[model samples]
Target: MSVLDQDLKTPIRLRSLTWLRAPWLFWGGLLILTWAVSHYAFDIYRALDARWIIRFPATWQPDFESRITAFMDWLLHDAQLFGILFRDVTRAISAVIEAPYDLVVDVLVTGLQQGIGQQAVQILPPLSWVAVIFTVTAVGHYTKSWSMAVLMGLCFTYLAVFGQWESAMLTLASVLIAVPIAAGGGLLLGVLAFRVRWVDRAMRPILDLMQTVPVFAYLVPILFMFGFGPVSALVATIIYAMPPMIRVTIVALRGVPEELAELGRMVGCTRRQQMWKVLVPSAKPMLMVGVNQVIMLTLNMVIIASMIGAGGLGYDVLTALRRLDIGGGVEAGLAIVVLAIALDRLSQAYAGRTVTQKAAQSQGGFAMRHRWSLSIIAVILVTGLIGAAASWLQTYPDALVINTGQIWENAIGYINVNYFDTLDAAKTFLLTWFLLPVRQFFVGIPWPWGLMAMTLIGLRVGGWKLSLLVFVLTGLIVLSGLWDKAMMTVYLCGASVVIASAIGIPLGLLAASNPVSNRIVGAFIDTLQTLPSFVYLIPVVMLFRVGDFSAMIAIVAYALAPAVRYAAHGIRSIDPQIIEAGIVSGCTRGQLMRRIKLPMILPELLLGLNQTIMLALSMLVITALVGTRDLGQEVYIALTRANTGQGIVAGLSVAFIAIIADRLLEAAAKRMRKQMGMA
Candidate 1:
């Protein structure tokens, strides 16, 4: 056998001699010595009050932000392609997008109009709430089951009764237009990437950066380029949400069986025919997963997109939150969650709809095959005629609409007044004992020392190429003069991730071991994952007030799902034959688990850790609104000021941190997999 083949067959634990050649011991000693020296220097700097030793000197930092801003200015105004100004190009693109966007909006919310202002007449009314609810319910029943239809029906009914129908419909209109464009664009790019090897290689890093960069980071540029309105918001939502579908499409297409590809070729099919007719159809099951992800992510962007004038339920929530109208904010937030759940369920059901089921349902006749579609059409016409007579059918009656805002306010007030001391005491205890100290330690470390430590870890995990990548990316943060803020981000994200992992791993273990726990935990995490990151902040901000403590709480809640999910998946994915082998070897349950399962699943746990870190970083950005001073805050401030340069820098700093953490953890997992002979 070749050397690589033989090495792959032999597990690292059985190769004792290999350790003799490794420099890990020397590196470990040097790492400890470097850490001690850095701490000694920190003490000296503290005594002498030399702040520059701990923090990079601002005067020496590069002026990247100004240069970036200048370039953007040129691109927006001065720069031109051929004979056309860039602004004109952008405007032309906007016109194209706006055509369909206006169509959806008019059909759903505004109603079709003719002539100008005073002379304008409504050609048609927007879809009535009754018609909308019926269509959604029928779609659910056709796609999945009676339970799904009922769920969708009740959700829309609640929206109408709660007086949020108009806002909800506006949001739905944006989603309806954005999803097809984003999904189609992503599908095309994914197909291109799959067919061309170099394209796949090129897109990998871009996709990583796109996903890791917080949504807020790119908003300023999009707003600047597209101009602030629903168009800009739609554009931002598309950009933010499109990456996942691309990733999912690439993965799904790559996973298609080679035999299937060969079968197409053997039948004398052209490459295009093979791809579109055979490969895509075979990958449809997985592609549907991508569609579901796209839908959920589009909804998640609603509130964030609203910041740029994409008005809807998101605007309502934002206005309420800014005024500290906690009750109103919670109501709107719940509306978002309800909308998310309804859309998520419908998309998932449609995706899960199989050929057999579809065919079986369609077998009766033309009318029978499309009974739901006909019913939906019938409802719309009936509702439109009735709405003309009794306007309440067109618009829910104001007096009959429910208002739970006062009740929610009263409950929050009761808790605040009665449990003020207890909550404050708990918050103080955590900040004083654990959080503050960790923050101070991270902040006190000299920048070079921190950089060196990370570089060394990268070297150990993945070698010199990884080490250099980590150094350069992190070093740019220092060069950009955002080192302190980056450290603060690291501190907050790291602490939250640690806490989440501690809680999640044990729960995941419990769920994996017990059937009832599995069902309960599985369902809970599924719901939690579907809710937008903003919804988590409302409840947290209410209870904790606003500070690092509150940010940490929100981050933990938003990030906890991934840790739990990955851990359970890892535990459940173990080979049954391995368990049988352990039993046959006369090992007890605990022995079998510790020696075999835990070691075997270590890579998966590492992956879970990686996901936890990524989520914590993303949530940290949203937490900036609550007054945490970190990289997220920098991005947020830049966004508010429309400073593209500053936002991009800070955003990149956050992305770099995430990329470093992700790569290091992935490297560790790879090493573990190699050692376990599973690579």
Candidate 2:
């Protein structure tokens, strides 16, 4: 195995000894070499570009763009038989889903999405904003969360001050409607999947597909069928948000011990009774986690929903971005973040409340005991009296409104004067010294060899089925002629994930090791996590200018929060007894972490990596706006043009990359679990 060995006498030995130790490195180099030869030495681009990537003429496989568009057109226009059946089915679904749409609009505003729902169903027109504010205050008091109440008030006040009350109300109403539906549907489906073996088998892949596909993909068909409005956005939001709920549900329910379910049966409980009284309650904590996730995801879609004319803060941000008004977009984006933070805190606090809270309500003071009832009655009378006294009391006065766009612009000017030069130099160094080389390595890979190398990776990680998937998807990208862009995305996302993991894992370890540190860092991570992806763009654009490097930084910034969060959770969740064992064995803190903590926490860390991948890909799409020439750019362009075919293909490529990473990680985790006797 040394230099003395004949097999070790070559460059292969050097690669085997160093770079190839990481699979990513090994395949990357081989693919780059293949492409270098193909492009520079042989000039294959002529033939490839001639067929316009239609049929790899070299192989005979069809291009994805042309074929997918043809398929979509056939399904929609040519397949009258199938089209009629689908049309009828969607018509029924559209009719059924509209009920909730009407209800949501009615509860939020009077004339919204007018004519969609019955006039008799509209309810909130009679209620003043003051009434709604007071109700939120009452709930806040009940939850013992003055901070949450203040956040909510600030959020609403900001919306009012900005004269965005109507838009803000629409956004909240959509979320209010979407969360329950997403959470409820997810819970039901999750329960059924958990209870039925076949259902679980069927659901796993479908959920994977649903979650991995970009949220924008949902708009294409739904917008076509339902036209535009709240219902379309609501449906897309539900679909986009539900996967996490379903996943958490399955994981939580299964986490409940078999002995507990057996105890329910031992008490002579029937199947339904046992499921209701024992299983569901046992899984409440995880179900609540799912609910928290559902809320965040639904909010995440606020801007994407705006793309289809679903108005609100997202629309405001989109409008600002469209006008190239960075200050205005940042303002709107801030409002969305505040809205997200308020919603996230409210949902978390309510979800985390214990039986003791209810017990206190029964046994404690009048404020606790009466909670919402007395507060509601009083607030109603006070608001009614105020409305009677002056009409201006119903909503914040226009005369008192503040314009913060100028403030944001002034702040940008200050930053540019003070820090822009330093930031530009650093960005230049990062691009010239680091990212360009890595990006070139990835983007230079020849299609055929890249496909084979990825297939090999699939074979090593999973099996033939995975290899086939890798082969097919990679081939699709090459054929679609979006190969360079897709690889650029791969390079950026991969680099960002690696950097994020490096930073996050150590930070997580620090937090995990100390209770106080955990709380402090957890708060910071929570704040970062709640900021909308849109908000991540503004500062980086200010610092680095519009480019791939800036996009990478933004992707990492948005992605890093989840990495640290899950890593800390994984490390902290390690069994205390195992740590005690390590201590009894005379291990130091460092040794205990290496020998005991890491091994036990590896599975959770892999799950974190999976999450990190998804977050990075999601951000990449947003970064495309900042001038990253990746699949996100294609998707972004597709958005502007409403190019369904190009968007779908590009989105699927991003999805396939994420799914492949997920599958590999999952495969590795399964192997680790088996080795550790966890499976």
Candidate 3:
């Protein structure tokens, strides 16, 4: 067809599309046209002649902050439920949570004491560092391989030698106590959800909210209800960590084969027995996966929970950051990384063991089977007997302990001094040329125009209900007087996500294309993911000082793994037959990737983007530590002031932004899958 014919057909197409005739097409077109004009052509405030549309006027903004704070105060100090004082109820709950936590802390961290004040004698020193290290190594050896044993031994030794043992132990104690509770609770809930349709339906959104909401958002409420202490931190960590375990539990249990359940029924097993014995055992491998997730998440929360008084390695890092002691922060951060790697590796090793391997190990005599346990007991006994004389056995001696803090500080100082101009130039160039302009553009857009654009996009992607949801959520941000801060968050998180994707996609492609590259990239990505998000701030802050640039670098480092992992998995998962057909059709490698592979993997890339966005938003909150003036900073400020309302509102605003992005991207991915007939 000539250009004239094509142009003539356009009028007929337009004529056929109207509200009464083709509402979806007509509305979609109208929305796109409206968005294009409002976003690109029409200056919103100038055209409307209303400054209130540009920035929500303070007088008009709702007093949600005060209202929320007041409600929290009443709930904490005066409210009653079912004729019971809420404060008393919280106290009772706190006691229950505190009991096990205290016991674990005493056993693993704080030494038992006899008497009081100066007369007090240390009846026991918190498991001798030597014993702890030996036990960790022994557990590693018993569960997996000598390599794992060596890894654990080295990790624990690093803590002891580097003067981080006590703090690391405190962190570990919390993790050890939290993991079983969170994982078990998650398992029970998941089982219930699997058994009951309504329970599953009800839990889906709650689980989504629990996982989507930033960890800092809940800290204020937890502190208010539970009182500020490690117990509050414990509660916060549980909430932050349990969602993944529950999600994994549901997925794992659902993935169990039906044949095993049928076999149990045929053998005269009751429903309870069938579920407990047949279904659960069959899902053990996957259940362990959930447990692993619980471990990792618990470690992540340890850092954030420190702000509320769960003092440990997290508190050390926080203190160091607060004082601007780069060396000290890096040392503490590295300790966290070491602890995380050890836990992650141990859990993974245990999870990877086969039923046959376990059964084989179980057949040994009692003494042989329990050799590692016996060795740990022997070491502890020996240390207790000799520790009074050889005090170093009880605690790592201060004189011998390594001080890498100075070394790290000196290294960072050297770099900053030697490369100041070059680093400053690059940072300035990026901020001035790209970041500032983008931020200004986003901040300058009228609130109404931005909201409408989102609503229209939501409608196009997921229809009217989603559009309404987006409108209300975004409108709430505006009314809460957080639109500008929210936009700043968008600017920061969006920039980080874009940079992460650019770096990750190529790496993912390389990993997907070659076995060696896959192994190398997979290992690197795994290590990156295991480190707590807080740790990322250390090196970046050291290099760039405190600013948005540092925060962006941290966010990118923390979020890059998902994008790479998802991209690699997506490409590697493509049907071999399809690739073969492309090859037979004379497509070059580049041509095949461009025309076939990339298109096929586009949905996966979108899903990866969704994950990247979620991670960046979560990291965005932590980035507040380095002085980013976004919603994260608002939450941080609220936390410091103990302003429950401000923190919750700011947190909800961040979560709303995340949810909006999540829903839009997910809807787009779903649509793509349908279009490709892959759904």
Candidate 4:
């Protein structure tokens, strides 16, 4: 037999064959060839043949400027009239009712501003950095460990030293307030959905849409309703952050052991009592995971909310990006990362401890002496007292106050003068030679033909239902008068996903093969996933300018995490027995991978594809800032002009697209899993 075949037949000696040709080599080579052809060969040919592509009549650019100006004019006029009428109505009503509650609200507002606000402002000077660090470390240690404690201490110290203490605290305060509200709301909704099948059915689509819809899409309607400020930011954050919690809670609750449910029933428990005493406790781990996810997502939204005047680290990051202040951006980004890690670890530890306690309790008490409940309680009480005392003394001051707006304005001014002029020259070259030509090819395809091709592919992969779903989804986009825009979005997102998969798959393979590489890549994935999506945009825009290419590049960077993670997982999950079988059959390394591994991992690879698509779409609204004409642009305009109806409609359209894609992909994944006997 050949050396490759002989090596594959030897089980124990396979470790030495790390350098042997694997199936990936062939696939990877094919991909490289295809990329070269697509990126260079086709590009060159397309450039040469560009004049031959049929050009459709250009649609009039919507009279956005005039329309927006007129809308604003009318809105201000209406607001003036409404303000006068509201004042007159309130006066008439107040004169008639003269209620004590109205007086109470007025007094409370005045008191809050005068007493609490003044005290907070005055006391801001005495709180020492050492004390703050100590407090954070103590809390972290109490919740988790010495490692976490040290990390937390360092994080706080960095925040204080870097002069972002006040803004950080404000952001923290908002999170502290918003997290509970979101968690409680999510828990309630989740419980309701679990109890009622119809509620679950009703909520499923809404939750899916909420999770997938671009962040900017919600800003328009929310801003219109609430107006722009921290309150509006809070509302948007809550909406965006709550959905994952609700889904997680529902999933966890449903996963409660049936035996436990029966035991609860046998104990003469009412349904409510059983739920509170048994179901919720049983689902604590999952619920906590949900809480952890909620906090992370909420924190993620904080910076984005700053764009609408939420005023926190998000604003700092936004300002930094606008001004190309890499140092400031990195600092703010690091703060966010530290916060995310601390919270994630603490929550995970809490969940694990709870599970351990439950297991220990099942085995009876004395053995569970490791329980540190009292210590935890003591720490909480001590921390609470310290916080209360500090509040009372009004001695805690803000750490840093850096106005980045001027920095941004000056930077933007410079860009307008020099950078854009350079960018415009590049833009002309790219648009004329590259983007326009490719876009024409995509858009020029007959819609019916495109629909048919996609539907058939869906049918082959996922069966008839998915096929119909894909068809309807594409059909709806066409009907919405956004067919071209949707196609462009699809092309950009698709290209990014493909490129991400190309890079990620190999990295995943490499990581899977090496323990050190695996750990490093995994950690990197965590960091990348936690970094706010906008951070990627700044660098991407800097490199590529504000256009489709930059947006696509950003999407690729952001979407790569899941592809790498899932692909690594899939490779690692390959059964040892299967590898043994390949060995016994004297399959070469390449043959083993081709005949066994790739086929076995197809389901998982598709799952990665699904995630890649989802993540790419999530950037829809964010990409608008880079100047791609898509649904995100519509959403942005709606927010800017305070048009709730338009925002909601546009948001729903994006949601529909996500849902359609999700359903189709999920169905395909399910089918593949079943076919592979992995379901």
Residues 1-679, model 2: lDDT tens digits: 6656855566774545554346777667766666564445224556455432222453553556667667766665556564365556656776777787666655555533333435444322434577767777667667656776776677676777776676677788888888998999999999999899999999997888788777766676556656677677777888899999999998999999999999999999999999889999988877988998999999888888887768888888777766667788887887777778777777778777789876877987887677578878887777767765676766668897777888887888888899878878887887887788777667656666577778877776666687787787777777666777878888899888988899888888888878999999888787778777777787677666788888888888888886798788988677789889889999998899888888888987898888899999888888877888888888878767766677788888788887888888888788678878889
Question: Over all chains combined, what TM-score does candidate 4 have?
Answer: 0.74
- For model 3, how does the per-residue alpha-carbon lDDT over 394-509 read when each residue is reduced to its tens digit? 88999999999999889988999999999999999989998887776666666777888788777767877888999998999999999889989998999999999999999999
Please give, for residues 174-260, the per-residue lDDT of candidate 4 as tens digits. 677678878999999999999999999999878888898788777765565455677667778889999988999999998999999
List lDDT for all candidates, in order: 0.88, 0.77, 0.87, 0.70
Error of 2 at 275 (Å): 2.9
Worst 10 residues of 1 by lDDT: 13-22
Per-candidate TM-score against the hidden true structure? 0.93, 0.84, 0.93, 0.74
Off by more than 4 A, model 1 = 1-42, 46-52, 115-119, 580-595
Give residue 93's error in model 3 in angstroms. Answer: 2.1
Each prediction's number of clashing residue pairs: 0, 0, 0, 5
User: Candidate 2 versus the native: TM-score?
Assistant: 0.84
Point out the worst 10-residue segment of candidate 4 by lDDT.
104-113
Give the distance in Å from residue 361's predicted Cα in candidate 4 to where it truly belongs: 15
Please rank every candidate by lDDT, starting with the best.
Answer: 1, 3, 2, 4
Clashing pairs in 1: none
CA lDDT of 112 in candidate 3? 83
